[model samples]
Target: MRAQPTAKSARCTACRIPSRRVHGFYWRSLGDVACFGRPILLLIRIRRFRCTIPECPRRTFAETLPGVARLPARQTDRLRSVHRAIGLALSGNPGARHAATLGVPISRSTLLHRVCSSDADPIPPVRVLSVDDWAWLKGSSYGTILCDLERRRVIDLLPDRSADLWRRG
Candidate 1:
């Protein structure tokens, strides 16, 4: 959909100072999730604002959408979240297939990138700790899973199952 922000003023991305003088606008294409059984592409009119502060480093900058999408994002945050979920559930080819069926056609590599780039949720303090070894190739390569016993959740995946870690366990 073609749309422009109705806000009277927008803050400079670099300086965070609000400006009403509109320098110009640029079109940004964002791949949003499907609607009405069809894929959605949003053509948003992003306003360019001249920095009112003379000392500010940026002379002109595009207004940010904040929670909607990142400045350099090609797809909406929600769509990326969906891709991340699909990747987490069934990474690589399987996830790409699933996403295509769901009306979000993203490449396997891109989907995997989304999953890796997504930030983990904040976890509570770990009162108790647990470690375990998992084989990457049926005992050929091993790694460690660090978990928080008090929260009953995984904290991180260590690359190696070292002897020091095993001794502590």
Candidate 2:
């Protein structure tokens, strides 16, 4: 099923700008919401709008739904949630296996890529921190990761796991 284009113009949640010029519309397949022990696929028609203000930094902005973001191929917010959960709960193969049950089709390598590609950085004034090392290519290459001990999330990844690197960081 597809959603119909309504008279309503969705406003940008980030910048609070109302846009009327829709670039295009596309259907996104979202996760199933449970109903009577059955899975229901949510077919959401999301709009890609042209930014009304030329002065705005972004030329085009997608209208965000309640839980989804723009430009991602996956339509389900559950996928992202599962990815994040897997990333935090377990590392390597185990995490990917766990994520599979949550309807996210990610491999171990994909999980690692997601972790390394993450742009989130912990804000400072962090009291306790954890430093650990992971082999990127099994003995050939290694990287050190810094984490916020309190938050239990990775802060940064360094190329080498060395005392000099830690000292410089």
Worst 10 residues of 2 by lDDT: 31-40
| Residues 34-152, model 2: lDDT tens digits | 34534446677778788777677776666666544434544345555556567767977889876665555577986776566553233567789887887888869998888888978
lDDT of 1 at 150: 79
Per-prediction TM-score: 0.71, 0.46
Q: Give the candidate number with the greatest TM-score.
A: 1
CA error at residue 104 for candidate 2, angstroms: 3.3
- How do the residues 13-120 of candidate 1 rate in per-residue lDDT, one tens digit apiece? 788889999999999999999997578999999988899999999999888887778858898888888888899999999999988888988999998898788453
- Candidate 2: what lDDT? 0.66
* CA-lDDT, candidates in order: 0.85, 0.66
Where is model 1 poorest over a 10-residue stretch in terms of lDDT? 116-125
Question: What is candidate 1's local distance difference test score?
Answer: 0.85
